[model samples]
Target: MSLTLSKKASEVKPSSTLAITAKANELKAKGIDVVGFGAGEPDFNTPDNINQAAIKAINEGFTKYTPASGIEELKKAVCKKFKEFNHIEYNTNQVVISNGGKHSLTNIFTAILNPLDEVIIPAPYWLSYPEIVRLSNGVPVFIKGGKEQGYKVSAKQIEEACTDKTKALVLNTPNNPTGMVYLREELEAIAEVVIRKDIYVVADEMYENLIYGDKEHVSIASLNDEIYKRTITCSGVAKSYAMTGWRIGYTGSSVEIAKLMGSVQSHQTSNPNSIAQKATVEALLGNQDTIATMKEEFNKRREYMYDRVCNMPLLHTLEPEGAFYQFIDVSEVLEKEYKGSKIQTTEKLGAILIEDFNVAVIPCADFGFENHIRLSYAISIEKIKKGLDRIEDFLNQLK
Candidate 1:
């Protein structure tokens, strides 16, 4: 007998970055020197102090189940985090912890969405936003933002995407794939629309501490008390503290919304990892000097990689103000053929890069942009240079 998947399950697409990562691993297994730029994660290991906290938790026999919404200790830490960095206020009852930033977002959407609800997603967004919305039986409205506007989808575009059916909008500042960090004014403008429409705002501040330059990220929750009341502000220790594998993320918002997410998380995943929760306390409360150092390193590498890619043949790059990726435009190379393959799209460019140059980058089609590739600068300066050199050599010979 044949089995069928549920319509909800069938609606989701595989993660595009993971596809490139899988091929990179395949080539690596075959003894190829594949340099994967497809990773959306930081290359740095979790800080030693955070690791020790986890060890301490385990040794102290603190391995039992935590509350569905997270332990009071960790929830308190999350509350402290918003107070420290964002200057917003929250209580333990208003926060829920999940496996990661994505998991937190999933909980938020699953708890609120009814079938066919509309979700507005600015394009060149994280790969999972549209899929998550669709999986929740909601319709995704895409607002395309290319290199023309700092890759930022404007408030006018967002206003057009809204309708009575619009239930929520996903905002990923220091965004994945494109690294477009929305400024305070930009977020306030969007917040105005959301407040007037009385729609929920899902704020994904996963890359909260990765901002470079003179830029500052202001939470939409801070725009006004009403926005704060309606916004589900999600953040994780993953990007900011380099604790990606720890699998602990959290959100702060209205008590009602938090209660709903807690209910969803209770049955779905139960509590988050217990040891990770203890470790996350240290990560959130510990000295953030390491974050500054990491950002400095990132800034240096970002500038270096930007210059190197700009000098590369057939590559057009935009300077991303935050996050570690350089979304290079490769539309000029379309229609060019190599090794019996006509490079007609970003997908072709990706497949060829993995197969030939052993360099893996996520194609823009995943992020709803068809003419670009996302390259992460989270690796070492030397590695970034090496990968760019290899990419340049391959593209130069693409004729």
Candidate 2:
């Protein structure tokens, strides 16, 4: 007899963005000049102060297994960060540290979801949300957010989508793929819906510090007391501190939910890395100037990329207010052919761009958007210029 994987494992889709990045690397290995904009991680190195803290922890023999939830000191630091910046109060027990932001989210889903429960997700979402919900035996219901809506759904939309089966809502501000940051008023409107519907909210604010211009990130949990009880605010040091390899993420929620998540994590992975937890304490309580420096560079690249997209005749995109991606609308040229081969979908266009133009971008089809593609500005300014030039040249050739 042949062995088979579980039904859930067989149905889950692999990330299309990662696939394109792998192809890009393969071409580069063969000495091709490939300009890649496919990575979701920052290109910068971890700051020296953060690195030094981890080194100190290692040298001091602090590498043993910590508490399942996390070390008390690191949990306390997370509380302080929430209080100071997000204006949200939480005791140490209300926070749970996991291996990464993704792990924190998985723990929440496993704790909250039951069979056939529904989770409302806004479209043009991070590709992982639906799969994670499915893995927890929950159903994901999507509400589409097009360019007209600033890629943000309204409170009315959320209200209409909710039903008795709805158990949670996944809200991502400074959103992945679209880079849309919800304003204070918008968040207030959504909070009302969550309170009325009596559903949990998973607020992913991973790119909160990377916002540009006069824009600010407002955590929905900080808006009021009831919303605080209903929301799990997820963040980490990966994007802001350039510490993706460190693998530390944290969440703040009600004590009840936090305890349940801690319990779920205990059976799954035991604890996050001990050295990384110590480093995160310093990342939160130590010097924050590194964040400002990285934001400055991201802003420069954002402006340059936005201007280039604006000048291109057929390409269109919203000016990204936060995060480091430019989600471009490529429907205008999708119907055209390149050398008698039709490029009718973003996936086909993406593959051709990498194979012929030597440029790689993520197709947004898996992100629930068709005829659109996403490019990251986390790369160098010179590379951004070259990639944009190649994209424009490729569009010009579409017949």
Candidate 3:
């Protein structure tokens, strides 16, 4: 028989967001002035205090491997942060520190999912959610939340999708792509469903610190003791502290599940870099100022991008109350043509923008939305202005 790859590996969809970002980087490497709106990380540098912690660790020769899950000190720091900020209590044994938030999520799926088990995910989700779940041998079930609803799915929608095989529900507040934060009432309603169904809740709070205006971040687990017992909260320093390169992420869960995840990680990647773990300890305890600065900058960029996109002809967008993206409905231009090429979908539309106008945007087809696209305001305001100008010009050029 001919050699073949694993069915799961073969079936995984490539990340559309990364593909566009890679193309933009490739053009930039060739000295092209490509304005990019696809980056998911902050443009700011990692705070000096956190970097100094890593440097000190290296000087002290703290670079060796720690326990597979993570060092106890860092885990304890994470516990303290969770307890204080999230109002969720956690013992050190209930925490697992992984290489990054993405890795932490993969480990979680692997630990909790069995073959053909179902995970309920809302549409316009982060591109990796379904792929990660399917890679772990689980099935992904999606419920659509329309734009008028702020792309937030309801408890009734979640309840209707539940089945005997349902194992978990993936919830991301200040959600990716859409950038909408679920209100306390909205989360309580979802918590009620999770309680009634007795299914696990996988809460990705990676953007917890980047909320704008009066929108507050709430931990669903903090709603009650029963839900806290069943929730696995994943977060990292990547978004909040401009430490994406540090690769430190963690989960707070029940001790039993945390132990299993640690066991799985032991064979997968062994442990996160010891130096980075030490740096993260400083990130948690060292300072509170860097985060405020970054939030202020991000809020300014968010407002600028929001106003520009909203005023563009044929484009409609939701005001992102949190996170750094504007999800735009571009259905008006799908039926138009440019340079004799008919644009029938957001994928084709995105390709043309990158190829011709030197602008890069993430088409939301991979995000489970066919008529929309996502643009991140993580770049400088100058770049944001230039990119929006190019986008408007490109659309106007379309016939």
Candidate 4:
């Protein structure tokens, strides 16, 4: 008899973003001059204050396990951050700290979803939402927010997509891939629908502190009492503090849901890194000036990348309002020929670029868009210019 693996695990797709980044690194190791735009993290080093806190923790012998959920200090800091930043009140017990934003999401779905439940996710999403829901034994129902809608879904569309099995909806503002933000009016409308439908909201606000321009980052949970009760607001120190390697993400939710997530995490992974937790406390409550500095730099790169992409023939992108990605509409380029071969999909285009043009890009098929690609502007201006130049050269060659 042949041995069998878990069918559920076997069906899962590896993250394309990570795959492309890995491929680029592999080529670079071979001394190839690859201009990569596949990174999802800031190129900046972690702040000195945060790093000092971690060193202090180690010096103080604070490496032992605290609690399954988290230490008291970090939880209080998370609650304080929620109150001060998100304008949402949460007690320490109502907050849970996990390994990262992804872990927090996994915990949310595991705690909330039963078998066969449905999670409504906006299309052109982070590419992990559906997989997480499926791994939790839930269904992922997509609602596409087209280019016409600024890559954002309306409350009416969400309501239309709902059914009795609909358990929750994932709302990612200052969203990934497209980098568009939801206004207060839009959140209010969506909150009304969420209240009417009696569904949970998984609010992923990892990029909250990274928002730019006049747009404010409004947490949907902070909108009203009803939505607050239903929301599992998730965030972390990864994007804002340049602490991706620290692996500290947290969530603010109701006491019952928080307890459930904590219980699940107690068995699954015991606790997040103790030193990282100490560092995250500093990240949340320490000097916040680094965030503003980072945001300013990102805004400049965003403008430069947007202008360059807009000028490139057969390619166009919405000026990213927040986050660090520019979602390019490459459908026109896909319809054209590249070196006498039909460039049918963004995947093919990506391969041609990496193999021939020495550039790495993330095709958006895994992001629920077949004719688009996502380019992250989280690197330096020099690298961004170089990569964009290579991309333009490729576009110019399309027949």
Candidate 5:
């Protein structure tokens, strides 16, 4: 009598950040001056040269389909990129280009994960890791890290979590929520366990060029030869070059993994947009001075926000050595009353801040950390300072 939708479509939860964005928009449309710190994107625009390249491609009728894996030129650019940045060797055949960093990860997860295979993810990770693993029919296992250890899981925890069913592990340096970049020494320890356990590692370096303070972003695959053989290096121009709308990301792995991903790409979405490919080639080979300028701006904002938030009495904020986020532990302010509403969860904290103070930040519960909330410093310094001033006032009242 009626058609039904697949269970896969129904099982997916609405994306966490998107929900926050919608609510923020609803408030903003009603003339509220809300400072949004929820989105994980740079506030910069795509570089002019890259944008021109896309225009040139479109004018020249470069609007057709590409190989499912990617165009040869784009793959070659990716090959040159790995050699230059990470000191890893890759041929064109070893790379596959997809829609965005998210799509690239989903492709990698789908290509490799068999049903019931376990994927080991570090806690306080990207919101999509566990979701993608589950969507691919893989079991997601998490190992938690705390502020005491600079928000990093140890080799012991990783080794303890592994079993015969373990298939893949995700390693995100200068990680999304915490912005904790793994030191080379720390990565070497994890890599040792990984190489011994014969588990595949997905090295997510989406924020590779955005380090600040004294921290350095290390590519885990570059540490050792054995780990390189089993690593899928994923990244995009989105975070680094402010090309989020370009929807181009690439991955480098063994030829076998690349080809299998190609198969997945063919059946699901075929090739990515040809214009994005041409634009990405320009981005990869063009002068990188723009990236340096953006990094400098982000660093200034990061330090300013870090110093201010870390000094708040009721909040415990760790200074992230890299990335533009400050993950603030907010357990001290969790009481039964915030504007007369019971404030128990970080979601409630965020909601109260939105309703009363007109600020938008992500509650940390969705990132597998219950006692925290993430504030992004990607906005202008004036807005950041003003928002913090408002938040500080609200927290003082709670105390």
Candidate 6:
């Protein structure tokens, strides 16, 4: 018999962020002194309280198959979180806990999208959005948000992108890669568009707790009853509580959508990890000071990285308002020659940096921008300084 594979699975692209991080790790394993800037998780360990919660659960033999949706306690905690943090009121029945934020998104798209339905995703988006949409048999429609706009799409742009087949719009605040947060007015306008178009809004607030400066995270679903009815709000303890490995994410939506996602999750991966669920409960309701500390440290790193990149010749980046990434525009650098050959692309520049400069950076082609690269500050300040110095050295050598 000829070898065969699922066409849908074959068509999906691997996550560039993970691939770059893996390569950086591989080099480190080989004893190379690589200063990596590709990490997406916090450098800090999970809080001791959260860890203790997991240990306590294990000691109590809390490991077992939970309800396909999640534990009632976790669901109630998520509902409380939504009420207090996001200003959105959702009951336990409206929530579904999954393996991770990505899994929550997968369940969402699976529950809501019919074949060929369109999901309007802004450009320079989290690289996984388009792939996940495609995997769920939904088409991804992109609208670009240029550098001048702080990498955020306007309500007008979103309104223009919609069609009769539009099923949803992805709104990621404290966005990955760009670190830009949408303003309240901006979200209000977008919410109006979402309602007028009568489409679902997938509010991905994974980095909600990581916003820097005076900017605050505002969930579009909280704006009004109409948009709330049409929105599915997703969040997790990964970024906020430094629990990426815990694999716990939850969402709030209508009871109908929640049931569908739960039913789909039942066969896919019954409940999130039992211990992780217990830990997540503590993460949501515990001390909460750790998040503020992590945010402060991340702000310091963000300022340092932004200043360094701004001073580097032929490199440009907007001051990131939130999250822990600096989305650098490397177009000028790519146009220049390094080692007597034109760099030409973000991938080539990244490869040269890793091979010669002993630095790892994520090239952003898969993120819908060919001339940009994302540098994450989710590492120690010392490592960040080293990586920036190498990047500056590389740029200085570009003729």
Predictions in order: lDDT: 0.87, 0.93, 0.94, 0.94, 0.89, 0.92
In angstroms, how far off is 209's CA in candidate 4?
0.6
lDDT of 3 by residue, 24-85 (tens): 99999999999998999999999999999999999999989899999999999999999999
Give the per-residue lDDT of model 6 (tens digit) for 367-394. 8877999999999999999988988888
The CA-based lDDT of model 1 is what?
Answer: 0.87
Tens-place lDDT per residue, model 2, 1-399, is 798879889999988888998999999999999999997999998989999999999999999999999999999999999999889999999999999999998998998999999999999999999999999999999999889999899999999999999999999999999989999999999999999999999999989888998999999999999999999999998998898989999999889989999999999999999999999999999999988899999999999999999899788899999999999999987888898987888888998999999999999989988888999999999999999899889988889
Q: How well is each residue in 1-399 modelled by candidate 4, as lDDT tens digits?
A: 899999999999998888778888889999999988988999999989999999999999999988999999999999999999999999999999999999999999999999999999999899999999999999999999999999999999999999999999999988999999999999999999999999999999999987888899999999999999999999999999999999999999999999999999999998999999999999889998888899899999999999999899999788889899999999899899988989998888989989898889999999988799999999999999999999888888888
Q: What lDDT is reached at residue 346 by model 6?
A: 85
Using lDDT as the yardstick, the better of models 1 and 3 is 3
Of the two candidates 1 and 4, the one with more favorable TM-score, higher being better, is 4
lDDT of 2 at 90: 94
Q: What is the C-alpha lDDT profile of model 1 across 1-399, one tens digit per residue? A: 698879778667887778888889988998888888877778888888899999999999999998988999999999988988887899999999999988998888888899999999988888888888888788999998878888888888888888989999888888888877898889989888888888999999988889888888888897789899889999998888888888999999889989999998999889999999999999989877887888899899899988888887778877778888898888888757777667898888888888878888888888888888899998888878878888888877776
lDDT of candidate model 4 versus the reference: 0.94
**Of models 3 and 5, which has the larger lDDT?**
3
TM-score of 1: 0.97
lDDT of 5 by residue, 11-67 (tens): 877777787888899999999999998868899889999999999999999998889
Q: Against the correct fold, how does model 2 do in TM-score? A: 0.99
Model 1: ten consecutive residues of lowest lDDT:
333-342
Q: Cα RMSD (Å) between model 6 and the true structure?
A: 0.9
Per-model TM against the reference: 0.97, 0.99, 0.98, 0.99, 0.98, 0.98
Kindly report which residue stretches of model 3 are placed more than 4 angstroms away from their true locations once superposed. Answer: none
The weakest ten consecutive residues by lDDT in model 6 span: 14-23
Cα deviation at 201, candidate 3, in Å, is: 0.5
**Candidate 4: RMSD over Cα atoms?**
0.8
- Candidate 3's displacement at residue 12, Å, is 1.7
